[model samples]
Target: MNLEECRKEIDRLDKELTNLLEQRMQVVAKVAAYKKANHMEIFDPRRERQVLDKIAAMAQYKELAPYLQKIYQCIMDESKNYEREYMKL
Candidate 1:
């Protein structure tokens, strides 16, 4: 494919990613609601570790596996923060 078309594809991919993130946020909001309703903790370190390990296991690049885990950890951290503020518990 041409460079222009490939660039457009990248933009489209980014838009798809943004849409997916919004949907994921909606799910996280629900999780926050449940947590507040049930008096559950917002942060779960074991879950976070599982997430990182899962991502690392799924990574294709050996050198990039840790980076992927780091990025996902950051995303999860922010998501948990959102849950905390949204639930206010």
Candidate 2:
């Protein structure tokens, strides 16, 4: 494919990713509500580790593991931040 085609494909994928992220944030909102009601902290190191490990394992290419982990770490960090803000912490 040409550079323009590649960019277009990326843009298409990005749109899908944006939609999925919005869905994930909706669930995160629910999680925040649950945690707030239960008086639980937003950060769960063990769960974060499990998520990172799971995504790493699920990665199709071994070389992609670290990159995927980094991306997910950022996602989890933002989720925590959203949870805090939602809970007024």
Candidate 3:
């Protein structure tokens, strides 16, 4: 495909990604509410490790595992931040 076509594809994929991320964040908000009610900490190292490992394992391209892990790490970090802000902690 041409450069313009590639960019358009990327844009299309990005729109889908944005929608999915928004859905995930909505669930994260629910989690934040639950944690706040239970007085639980926002950060769970074990959970984070599990998520990263699962994400890495799910990568279709083995060579992309590291990059996917990094992307997920950032996502988890932002989730924690959102949770903290939501809980006012």
Candidate 4:
């Protein structure tokens, strides 16, 4: 594909990513409510490890595991922050 075509594809993917992120954040809201109801902490290290391991296992590009981990860490941190805000803590 040409440069313009590649850029258009990226733009389309960006829109898709935005939609997915919104959906993910909605789920994060639900998770926060569940945790609060159960008096559970927002940060679950074991779950985080499991998520990272699962992502790493499913990753198509092995070398991108570290990058994916970094992105997921940021996402998890944001989720925790949202939980805190939602809980008014």
- Please report the candidate that would top lDDT against the real structure: 3
TM-score-based ranking: 3, 2, 4, 1
Q: Model 1, which residues run further than 4 Å from truth?
A: 1-6
As for TM-score, the candidate ahead, 1 or 3, is 3
lDDT (0 to 1) per candidate: 0.90, 0.95, 0.96, 0.92
Off by over 4 Å in 3: none
Sliding window of 10 residues with minimal summed lDDT for model 4: 80-89
What lDDT does candidate 4 reach at residue 22? 88
RMSD of 3: 1.1
Q: Which window of 10 residues has the lowest lDDT sum in candidate 2?
A: 80-89
Order by lDDT, highest first: 3, 2, 4, 1
**C-alpha RMSD by candidate, in order:** 2.1, 1.1, 1.1, 1.4
Candidate 2: give the clashing pairs: none
Measured against the true structure, the TM-scores of the candidates, in listed sequence, are: 0.83, 0.97, 0.97, 0.91
lDDT, candidate 1, 14-50, per-residue tens: 9998999889889999999999999999998999888
The true-versus-predicted C-alpha distance at residue 57 of model 4, in Å, is 0.6
Per-residue lDDT over 1-89 for candidate 4, one digit per residue giving the tens place of the 0 to 100 score: 99999999999999998899889999999999999999999999999999988888889999999899889898899989998998774
